[model samples]
Target: MISNLNEPDFIFLLKSGDTSAYQQLITVYKKTVYNTCLNLLQNSEDAEDICQEVFVTVFQSIHQFKGESKLTTWVYRIAVTKSLDYVRMKKRKKRFGFMRSIFSEESNEPIYDRPNFIHPGVLLENKERTEILFRAIDQLPENQKTAFVLNKLEQLSYVEVAEVMEVTVSSVESLLFRAKQNLKKILGDYYKENEK
Candidate 1:
């Protein structure tokens, strides 16, 4: 019954467990959250899993939202945090697996497994370039990567990114600047190596 309400009202309904409110919230945010997860994790399955976790966390913790930022900003923050957590956990597992393989007699694990991610919306003509770009983005430092994803890929404003990241607008600007510089160096090195 809460169709056209503002965010505060929508949140009120959600906190009270209104079914429509929950539906509306998911309908409005599912793709954004999923994309955020996918861009960070670079794997659809992990993204989907983390997307569900983000929603669950949101539902469970709605009462903790202090209204300091826009509802969407808070949601984005949750999505980013969950996605990064998944990435960190995956890296830990990979490192542990590597160590175990070193000690095992018959271990045949690959040295590195890069994620094969093609954003569903990318044009066919740009798939190769997109893949390269994604790989470069993946190599970025975590903060720079998060800022880049939210600003460049998700098209959020610097102010909005700062809100989501809980940083100042200037910090967001700096992160984006560093992300771009790093991406250029990465892509340049890749192309140079390939041209050899």
Candidate 2:
């Protein structure tokens, strides 16, 4: 996307072992891929490793791109898989970031300072809800989780997700429905516990 040229040009350059093209491509996509990883891992070091793996896979497989989807989409697909695998393999999965309470009154929060799961102000707020949702999202099945992340959080279109996922639009739709239902069930249970 940074080059604004097309996926074909990137693929050609990448296939010919043009390291510069690979560098440019990484620059274009690193943050989005890293964020996807961080949200999934909730760990900075692991997220960094997953990001590197995604790019390494990209460099190794440019020839396999087949122009099926945008290079960005392919990269994200690799990243999501890597992140999910990283999470499962790590298996620490406990809730984290509790230190965010120290600076709750501060307007700006530190990135590594640990986000609090609760708030002092309004009993209902976005931060707490998002945290709960992300926690449940972490428990989703692989395909459903991947679909939700790429299509919903990343804002990719269904057609784009379909190409990256190597499935039809209808399948993406079906996965999303199941994903939503599963998430709703999980979060509903969470809220119910809160009511107790």
- Strongest candidate by TM-score: 1
- Give the clashing residue pairs of candidate 1, or none: none
Candidate 2 on 1-196: residue-level lDDT in tens? Answer: 5567676777898899998887898888888898777766666777788899988988988878787566677787788778877766544332232344354566354344334323222245476676777778777988888889788877788988887778899999999999999999999999899996
lDDT of the candidates, in the order given: 0.90, 0.76
- Show the lowest summed lDDT stretch of 10 residues, model 1: 108-117
Query: Candidate 1 — which residues are off by over 4 angstroms?
Result: 108-112
lDDT of 1 at 137: 95
Clashes of each: 0, 0
